[model samples]
Target: MATADAALRDTFTLQGVTAVQPRRPDGGFDWDWRGPRNDPEWAWFFNRHLVFTDLLAAYQQTGDVRYRDRILVTLDDWIAQHPAPSGITFSAAWRPLEAARRVMESWIPIYAALRDDPAAFPPERRARFVASIRDHALHLRNHHAFSGNHLITEMLALTRLGLTFSDLPDAAGWRSYALDRLARAYEDQVYPDGAHKELSSHYQRVVALNYQELLDLLRASGQEEAVREWEPRVHRLWDYFAAIMKPDGTNPLNNDSDTESVAALLRQYAPHIRIPEQTVRLPWAGQVIFRSRAAAAADAAGVRGSGFGVQGSANAAAANNAKPRTRNPKPAAATPPPLLYAFFDTGPRGTDHDHADFLHVSLSVGASDFLVDNGRYTYTPGAFRDYFAGPSGHNVLLLDGLGPDQGPRAVTAAADAAGVQGSGFRVQGSDSRFPSPAGNPKPETLNPEPAASAAPAVEIAWGDTTFASASRPAFAANPRAADWRRLVAHVPGRAWIVVDRVITFSPATLTTLWHWSPECTVEPVPGQPDSLIVSRSSATLHVRHAASQPVPADRQQITARSRPSPQGWYSPRFNMLEPASCTQLDQAIRAPLVNVWLFSPAALPGASIRISADHRIVVQLDPATSLTLDPEAPGKSAVTGTMR
Candidate 1:
């Protein structure tokens, strides 16, 4: 049997594009590997030289002369074409930092593997490589990004390069400056509860991996004090992953995130840190996860892998059972099943790369994701980019057909207005200029009023009933017009309840949207205009709404448009998008508006809801249990009563 490292070496593949495949050294080389590809951005990323790591690994495992020769030839060609402090590699500000970082990371292992082979890494060629690393590191030291992940990546690369070349005259200064910046990044970037302030799961993983790599280098170099100081923060970062990771090992596609899994991170680092098995709520991070007890029990029994570990046995069993069988399967147990997994987000108005998806929720059952966040496809400025990063891509309320404000600046403006409005109780008139209902408002024209009440606040409680609540200004333009409060509750073995309440001072329009996977189908319940059935595979969800007046049939519709519309779209990967089912319900709001949705594996029986004159809500989920909510006095509102 092949060793684990050997197996990994055998399965090496470069970035999915085959256009830049390196050729053998025939006394001549092509430094410009992109050839005639028109995509400059793709070529830029490809030419970063990260893929050389694969060649290094292959040569180390198999002792292949071809792989070793190719590495030297490519390095020689690159150095000859782009000298120190010049050429496209060093001239572009972004490329130099990234190229310096990737080159250091990819070349270190190869240099280590071939250090003894004088023929492969002759002293002159080795000096050239060292000079290139010095130039790249000096360039990064001179130029710095403003903040966020870019700064983090650049500093991390410098730290690694400094440690690797510690014998150099200025290496100590480089290490000190890089470590100081890293410490500041740790304080500013990672939230108190381990969430990356940028609020992107994809970038969270990226940042975590960068930290882990730095720590590993520290440990290898006997820097115990540095490792000790940084270990806990790295563990906190992984804990966030353990909390929000879905049943399928992926995470919620929060804010500029892709459909990437945390399994690889866990697989690499699980042995070093402690992994949590129970549910957790990261209050500071504005995230809450409701884990299934049944799943936990199975995981404890070793029937299912824990903490994002690979399930090799389960995969083998599945592969063995691929063929159809005539035998009858055993009946399922009669006990109540576990509640589906649920993730809630009510974080701060995110940073630059973050999306405006406040109070968004994602749910999954077994291995299938039901309600999902429209993932970020690309950073390119266009219709798709705007939609994925806006409020319409999430499961939230769009008041008067308008999404939330864009970023921290907009959020601060709204909060300041709310402070003034609350002190004076002023209401803006209809003549007040607001954004167009089309959902695209010019930056200069966006002056959303503050809510008459207050800014959004989130509360979480766990036990028999796991739930989280967020109360916030629903509309940026007409913040004083209405206040929105959302509650998400997970009742194990029963159902998941999503309650949305909007209290308005004047007439307004409320559009509640739910985005599901492309595989799901939705339809209105027969003879029940207030309810809809959303089904995907074996799971189903029943959504209901309570309004002051009857809803017209035209206002409730399901769409799966491929265009860049707000109603229906899904992006599974970067640079790719497809149509997905989006169920929308539009209702006219005069007084307090309450809408409830119940999700279950089995069909849910009909329930009754009553709203008192004082805006209190009574919902009978089943014959045995009832829930009462009074928005006016939230502390005293949540009561469980028996249905008579």
Candidate 2:
């Protein structure tokens, strides 16, 4: 019987089809075996040849001749089946680019493993391998993606291949073109604040890994000048990941982000970068992290209690829970005041990979995620895709069942009229909301063109143990008929207060959506019309809302049911979806809409939220700590005593 590793190396399994037969001796493989050429799953499976690298690793580890033979056979089969400019590989621009990257990344290590052993990889085989790599580079150089990470990956692959095979006849031209394109992509796709234009933390990690490999290749080739030129930008990219990572070493699924990808990148690159041990704020990226000092102290004490050894309770706990929390309780907390990590997205509606989620926040206590962004399940365009990328999947204000401006495309006419082009125009429409006139216009009167939504003007502040950010009237779907402002403040180890204030001139329904991790259970607080108790093991999140208008008990709903209309589903990885606890607060807009969320480790000592007629919010987290927030002046919150 074949070992598990041997089986994996010998065959490619995808979409539940294990041990798929390889190509015929004549070198013809089934490109579209399951169904139509437009099958989304087939497209996804075809592009993800990541297993090729796995096979190479297995061969290196076990010195397995079977794995090496499999690699050679597969490479030869693919090259023969996908001849230059004629096969499925070159039919679509994206597929070819993806194949090029996968091939380049897979071939390098395999070549290294077999370099010294001429019998394993003879001169003829090496020549064939070089020819195949050259073809990939040439194909990528000619076909570029429309934008986003696709183009970036293509350029990175080209550059790596050119540098690796610098002795080839066309290597210099490929190297030069790839280098120029990569530089431009860094400037265009990376924000000045170090955030990727894609806005998805997962994609940010992808871009980072691509650049890290590029730098490694350049440095190996003695290209110090090139390495220096790109190092700072790459470091900034790492900084964004460092700032957004949670206590569990994963990032919030703010857009189409896969939790697994985020965790993998953190594991791969975190040690090489200079990540601060405490709180961090990236104002330009509109992100902030508040690390609990108490949590750190407790972790330190837990290690000491475990004999002060290298393998302490902290390490054991981390090791036990290394896989992303699927449907289990988090490892036991080290002590009181568990690590609190929260991410607030107040920046632009990033590139195509980003969802229309503005002012959406994700919260976690220790290793367990509580409130989370609905993750990207698949890129296939359908109802699921729309819901995942729309406001329904996020924790934000949904007015009259409509999300932020998610029309087919942004209205560039207004920017063109203003004589602005490129980024100046793009920045003008970052808010993802359609502009409204000053008075209430009938729904039919609203137009998608000439007046688009303006980007939210944001203000952020970071203190020793507190972080605060506010967005002003960012959503105006109808011309001035409604105004929305989101204020988020976090006091590490204590609580997080999010206040959503909406003022409307017309009759509208306001719904606040909160999506929690699938492991959490949510229920309405007994006898409380506007509160919910979300419990996950020992940790609990106390949610309380106070509004000037009447809020009925029937307005609150907690469901883990999946529906076609994006209500209660969480996708931690691509192509997988699970039911999650989704809490919605529905209220009629008569006066200002104010909803408050207070998240903590356990039931609070004194949990009461009062909204005065004058629009001032008073929140009491405990006997000694209380906050008075003036909605009109979010930055001027008065604190009675120190909770820390």
Candidate 3:
């Protein structure tokens, strides 16, 4: 390894070094490994550390005085703003001490590089840096105990520093402790299926960043054997990361994913490990490790394999369901949509991380989002600035219009997990429900899972009374609408919707809320049966079962176009149930009431119904109906009357 003093001797050679910045859409330069922009809170350390680390690497690689000078200028800026009582420095710029620890680690290399260049870093700057480092380490070793990622980073820095200041036993102890913590953290935080608990893209980047440091530390310390030992585990993590990526190169962006450059970083590692250029489509453990290992082998052999770690190897593992240590074989599709489902139980009442979308589920069909989770709006203004992050952002009830309170204190540990089908996932929480119409405040739980193994479908089980039934409604507008007009003469035509769940309703009158928002005008197409055209948008409603023949215009009466107030669009919770007679009401008391919403268009005089188990029909009567759904009901029973 090149010593910092050796590189410092050749500072003049730094003149011609060319840096290839991360690319941008507009062709500008960005240094972000994942992308140009990132969350200010998290990216604070990431960017600062990146610039500092690059400078440190440059100085170390080329003995560049200019690089050390640039780093000192930035370090001084931080020192001036955060001078402590001991003339050290600290920063409140980020939350969760884990973030600060990263900033701490970035300085170790900078210090080593800077200490070698006397002219570039003065005594005062070095003193300040040391003071800050020791203070932070002291606090971390005492106060910050829950930091998983921070422990690894801080331990590495201490280990590096310990080599120089041989008297520090704490540094070595910290390193030992970090290794144990890492194994446990990896076991718990990283699922057996390799899914991350946070599911945030930013966190994925952080994981990569953490691993890079560990790999760098191992490599620099002449511990390549450790890297070889860890190669499989790291490969599994990378494989997990690759599996969650969408075909379009974007992650699902669920949870707290703000960074967009993760795809680029993954590409960078692909060549090193020999992952193919195409998107991965398999669901297996340690895929990234396998691909990387395969890459290493192929690069060494200078040839590709027919069945060894190739891209799109789905059936590879299908033939082997036996336990581990069994010899494994290799295998191999699509413009498949990004279909994901998430459920929030515990009623969005936990910490700021918690969302008030208990019993809420969202679907993304094709590229468009349906029943969406209103993506996060802002992070600085607490959590209330974005109404969508509140209960209103979901398809479920807003609960007497009361959203979760956004206060100063942090809310944590509000989610619970249950495994389904090995790869199946369920996260539940306490206090997950809101007040029902009957004034009963029940705790809601959101239970969501993939509808099938390796399919583009998800089943969300919302254990809340409010989500009794849900149906996706589709409508076609006749004569469409005039260009540039917000209001259009919409000739309502009927389409079919497939309801996945049986309507949970009491023996009373059942009402359905036909809610539409995006603020488009809804015009009632008079005389057309099974039709209503929204002026600004097009809609398609699918029926799960039961076909309807198009009723002629002469047969219908009211052209009821409802314009709901305050929010510009319509959210008409239309009551569609007939009052059951007293005699029959008792019989229907406990059984679920399912409703099929079918609209007919005149052009196709006969309405053709196509049903998949894909539609939603949320009933409104009994809040407890969901708990009673027969576990033995066939998937088809979720929807009846197939007429496609």
RMSD to truth, every model: 11.1, 10.9, 16.9
Candidate lDDT values, in order: 0.60, 0.62, 0.34
| TM-score between model 3 and native | 0.49
lDDT of 1 at 194: 66
Q: Count steric clashes of candidate 1.
A: 0
Candidate 1: Cα lDDT at 121: 77
Candidate 3 segments whose C-alpha is farther than 4 A from its true place: 1-74, 77-106, 145-170, 219-229, 259-262, 270-352, 357-372, 381-388, 395-644
Worst 10 residues of 3 by lDDT: 481-490
lDDT of 3 at 189: 53
Model 2 clash tally, residue pairs:
4
lDDT by residue (159-260, candidate 2, tens digit) is 877877779999899989988888898877876546777778878877888888888878888889988887777776776775666766667887778775
Q: Is candidate 1 or candidate 3 better by lDDT?
A: 1
Q: For candidate 3, lDDT tens digit of each residue in 378-419?
A: 454533323324544443332113322222112222222221
Candidate closer to the true structure by TM-score (higher is better), 1 or 2: 2
Error in Å for residue 167 of model 3: 8.1
**Top candidate (lDDT):** 2
Model 3, position 434: C-alpha lDDT score: 17
